[model samples]
Target: MNMLRPACVLALMTLTACTQTWVDTKYQQSDRFATWVDSTPSPYRLLAGDDISVVLPFNVELNYKGRVAPDGTVAMPFAGNLPAAGQTLAQFGETVNRALAANHMTANAMAMVAVTQTAAHVFVGGEVGKPGELALTPGMSVMQAIITAQGLLDTARTGEIVLIRRSPDGRPMLRTVDVKALTQQGDPAQDIVLQSNDTIFVPKSSIAEVDLWVDQYINKALPFNKNVNYDINGARSF
Candidate 1:
């Protein structure tokens, strides 16, 4: 009948809208996120706790191992403590080479500064096997982060793993990733590069969750805050 035609058309429209929304959400978690991540800069900056191994290939005597001081400097044998916390590996290496050339310590010396240890912080929480702050490594990806957290649990929402990061302007931003799509579908684009202070949160499949727990675990402990909850993970020996 004529009345039935109108009802059928309305139902069809509703279904179409729902399908479009589902597609859009999936695209945001996949292709759209990939585009955004590809455009973001991922340069690694040296931090105070990071250990740098400087090797003067021509002058082995100048070779030394040291940590970047809290004052953003490194103590070399001849160079003393020079500024280093803000520079990248290449930039710091160039600065060291220039210093050697300027002081006439070693002419034609190419200084190489390598990060033997990175003290970069990355937090992993939610339905992971282990949830805690990890020491980040160069070239680490989101998938690797999950692995370092001891992999995911059976209750993990594989499609709802959220990455919390600070934007260029220092504002917090969130990106959802379909981890199953990355692992099962073999989509490398979903595997985004992680930066320091980044947090990966995997919510339960049945519930939508936020990162307040991550803040508690990180902020409520140690030098970050004074309220130390020694029972956060388990009973401690020390």
Candidate 2:
């Protein structure tokens, strides 16, 4: 009888620990999504292949709107072929300003550069609501990307969304993001800033389902935690 008492106490303690852990995990995941509502704006740098519109203020003749050439140069009437590849919009604007000044075309001229369109795009593939290439616009966020992909499919694993990107040296990099947390909890941090040529993959809901299953298992392992045990494990035996 004493041994049964200890077992019962141990079970109760285990149950309490499991309940706390489950609550912590739930809260953590929920908090992550909740914080996304007030997330800071994404600061993604422009890259090659982005289309830009450069206006010289009442100088339509000098204004250039076109795609960044393969070599990263845009041909302006007076500026000739200028380097724009691998340069941010600000840098490109500065380069254009310097070029215009050097060529004596415009002295102390103010150049208004706007990204009318963004050619830098990423691909979203697999078990998503829409699987295809998604064009990334300036100020685009991860949530936007997923939304552009038509949201996740019914079988989409919110936590298994994988972001594949290229490193500075062109090496492939992979990052796993939680889409469920982002959408359900409003966590903006999980919505990482995307880059040109980035790829997002929404694998089937295996991972999330597994996590839920694990949570269920932990609940089942707990003793006297009726609420969690019933909710997670299933109908009670007696």
Q: Highest lDDT among the candidates is held by which one?
A: 1
Which window of 10 residues has the lowest lDDT sum in candidate 2?
31-40
Q: Which regions of candidate 1 deviate over 4 angstroms?
A: 1-38, 207-238
Q: TM-scores across all candidates?
A: 0.68, 0.61
Tens digit of per-residue lDDT, candidate 1, span 114-176: 998887877777678887677888878899999999999877778867675655665545567
User: What are the per-model C-alpha RMSD values against the true structure?
Assistant: 18.2, 15.2
Global Cα lDDT for candidate 1: 0.71
TM-score, cand. 1: 0.68
Please list the C-alpha lDDT of all candidates, in the order they appear: 0.71, 0.64
Residues 10-30 of candidate 2: C-alpha lDDT, one tens digit per residue: 433443343333223343345
The collision pairs in model 1 are none
Model 1 residue 137 CA deviation in Å: 1.6
Of candidate 1, the 10-residue stretch with the lowest lDDT total is 14-23
